[model samples]
Target: MAAIQPPKAQYQQVAALLRERIHDGTYTADQPLPSEPQLSAELGVSRQTINRAMNLLRSEGLVRVRRGFGTFIRGVPQVTRDAKKRYAARNQGTGAGDVEIKALGLTPRTEYVEIGRVPAPAAVATVLSIETGAPVLVRRRHLFANDEPTQLADSYIPWDIAEGTELLNRNVGRGGSYTRLAELGHGPVRFTEEVTVRTATDDEASLLELDGGQPVIDITHIAWDAADRPVEVALHVMPGNLWRLRYDWDDPTADEYPTVDGEV
Candidate 1:
């Protein structure tokens, strides 16, 4: 005899019904969902099955559970634009840091301004193609969204290019560093980014106010000029939960011309 199966997949069925109801506004945002036991009784399923279903929804960022109370329908998952999109945007306004938080209906602010020349890390020096321990101007900013710290960034630029300009000033002025660079005749024509996800360091965890074991997205930005000279190297650290990176590309390779890669 075949083992007994509960008609079909109970958890998925329950989750689908709940998702539809939520979509139709039968369960409103921030509104408490029915208790697992109540749902189990109503759906004619086991409490365990109901719980798994709720957990599935939670993983989708569509709902949150309040132990001993009940689950609640949450608003749409807040998402930050893909880093690539931000870099490619036309320079008509503020920086990506400013635009992102605002789009999410949160005000953006920068604080903890520590700007000066510092010895570049060996990895950074290699990417910048500068000698290790060479002095580079470092601008560190702690970015916040709605008063909550969300990103920590350290921008490294060649000392010659960054010195004697607003790049060293508290304000980058006008469009941003790109504008300044254009004025200096080394405006970026191409960009490259190395993206990674890693566990946060103790200090990073503290600064981002992250709970134990939360990961982070680390991005290394390298901007180059038309002649293939690297002009900027910036390191950005963003809290894992606060942002989602997206990339939409036409094709990996469809041309014989030199694309993003430095191949000819």
Candidate 2:
């Protein structure tokens, strides 16, 4: 067979078509996609064009590539802002008040490699409402989803509460730290989150599997205790292309809600 020329626009069109199929349930989540040769034949495009299209889909999080396995549709579903707000409300009274963390629908697996008392930095101390240089129990974590590093979180708990508790010695592989804090009587009653878009650092890029200088979403959150004292500060960095942030606000007095915020 003669070598087929690749068409860039055709490749993009193929990628868009595949994305639409995935969104509309034509290609179900976690199901293996047609092989490149098969897809090329079906779409009437060259295998090279199919390959490029698949790459685009993968980067856009519509598909996943396994080392020894074929490409599969990514199973994680996107949560809209309204859905997140509903989730947050539902989790308020439960022990799993960190439900927003779960609603992202990313499977979280944590490795607790270290737990020890360290002098709190000035910034951390200010957030925790403690004296600067106070002792705090630091928990270093590598958080993963589908076995891929999704977040690297460091949690700081005051030493007076955390060091003596089982939280120090236990390995909370999944739903560990947050659950333990709830058990330790410092469960978060309120949370404040701030989001910003910024370039990833070299270390962040390596750990989060992101391209250097690529834009990523930075979520800084402070979880507060029942008494409104800050219990933890968590920094989450997500691949900008793979995820989105959503928020919802309601004005109860208004008879009709206005969607004038340019959101949605």
For lDDT, the strongest prediction is 1
RMSD of each: 6.8, 8.4
List model 1 lDDT by residue over 1-264, tens digit each: 998877658789888999999889899865688887789889898999988887777656567554555677654345666766676454757686677766778778898478888888898899889999888888899988766677899888888888888888878887788778878988988888888999889999778765446678898889898778888888888767667777666775677667687878
Between which residue pairs do clashes occur in model 2?
Answer: none
| Per-residue accuracy of model 2 over 98-150 as CA lDDT, tens digit each | 34446676555677656788899887788788999999988777666656665
TM-score of model 2 vs. true structure: 0.59
Badly placed stretches (over 4 Å) of model 1 are 1-77, 88-90, 252-264
| C-alpha-based local distance difference test score of model 2 | 0.70
Model 2 lDDT-worst window of ten: 90-99
